[model samples]
Target: MSKNVPGIMRQKPITPWLYLVPSLIVMFTFIVYPGVNTFYLSLRNADNTAWASTACKAGESCWGIFENYHYAITSEIMQTAFLNNIKWILIMVTGTVALGLLIAVLADRVRYESVAKSLIFLPMAISFVGAGVIWKFMYNYESGTNQIGLLNAIITALGGQPVSWLTEPQINTIALIVVGIWMWTGFCMTILAAGLRGVPEEILEAARVDGANEWMVFWKIMIPQILPTITVVITTMVINVLKIFDIVYVMTGGNYGTEVIANRLYTEMYKSYQPGRASAIAVVLILVIIPAMIMNIRRFNEQEATR
Candidate 1:
């Protein structure tokens, strides 16, 4: 046993690294290498066969070596995509978190709790593309005919004109965000429900005993205790909304002012065959997402330390 101890000690450090070799190789090949390559491509031309033009004639409009990034920042389609993504981040994130928390709290008091939760979470089981397709039917518009879309049918039934839910630039983005909220609210509810379960029952009871109303108990004691969970949910929602693509693509094809960053990136890469602009868009997305990811990690670390 004594002789074996020296040999075991020698192997211990290397043993963990040996286990990590496969994952390291995979990460470098897929994540790190692609990330670096994308950055390199962003500096090149549409086909990535040459460096982007940096020279300009006196009268010509040009963006120099960063032409791709210039297009991403200033082009009309990219601008629309950026604004729409910002709207998504604000509205979709808030709606999901708010509705999810409300439903979680209310469901806890209901007799059929499991049934309610199951129904709410049902949408999450469907893929985003599937959900988008289902809702597209719900939002479909056909003029000079009987309303085929459920929403339009309801409006016509109530003596209102049929509304174009997926088009007409003013309301289109809002229309798409509604689908996002519907799909993700269930997820937020499930996570928050778990956090709610961790609140100390004794603390809640004591608050009530001290003349705290139900609202007071929820606002003061319960909310603070579960705040970290709420933070996690909010950050998760933000990240998801930032990369929103499938729903926009399936439902709107990014038409009628519904363009989002990811969809625009797809359009540049595949349809326009502009690899450089697509790569620049991807890099921009990563930069935007990193801060949220870092915040989430720090929050998680704090929770672990407390544990």
Candidate 2:
């Protein structure tokens, strides 16, 4: 930005760019270079000795460059992982945001708002891995006297069978989603509470005076007023959902059909020792996230404009 001086605007020169040199250097070194290289590697065969081929015949190398992308798209495990990632986004984002908004609204009317909020938001203080570990113990399903998991213990006490919570594909996915929701709900509550606090008290009074019921006011007025905040929260949560790794990694290690994109990339790169496939997966993930990042940036700009 330039200021008008004596009816003339003067543009800054190389000095401004000079000031950006250090940060730009770091960005290019850490982000830009790696990103470019990842794309390059993604185009190479799984072994990276040559360009990838699309052939998938007998006695032929199926680890061609495009083969990784094809495998990612066609493999049963990859499909499961992709679908589970979608499930994660839907459950974690909606559940966390909805629960957070509910808590935020309730806290606003409570005398012990700070205490209630502190307790609810306390989970946000725990690391994702720690939260997963805690929940793992909670879902333990040891046999007989060795049963120590809280869930199994409670079930058994209620005269029910002790079920394996994390090892079963059908149940494990949902179980991991629950842990994600728990870890992130507090973050949503804190942000939305701030957004709610920013609402004008006078507007709320006006709505009340107009005979708007609490539910009506919440849905029609308060929510609309904080819509921008919700948009930001949703977009942030979506991004988080896409990169979700720690909780799933800690609790299931992508086992029993609980894999997500990041976890797959991890296994492909390290566990399976397939850099080309890993880079391809990375590229696939980056492509998926670009649109979301763009939308978030646009919303951010819109928010700033309003403020």
Q: Which candidate is the best by TM-score?
A: 1
lDDT (CA) per prediction: 0.91, 0.87
lDDT of 1 by residue, 1-307 (tens): 6566776466655798899999999999999999999999988997666787642246766787787888888889989999999999999999999999999999999999999999999999999999999999999898954999999999888888998988889998999999999999999999999999999899999999999999999999889999998998998888999999999999989998899999999999999898899999999999999999999998888888988
Predicted structure 1, TM vs. truth? 0.95
**Model 2, residue 73: what's the lDDT?**
76
Error of 1 at 86 (Å): 1.0
Report the lDDT tens digits of candidate 2 across residue range 175-231.
998988888888999999999999999998999999999999899999999998999
Q: Which residue window of length 10 is worst by lDDT in model 2?
A: 1-10
lDDT of 1 at 84: 95
| Error in Å for residue 2 of model 2 | 13
Question: Could you tell me every candidate's TM-score relative to the true structure?
Answer: 0.95, 0.92
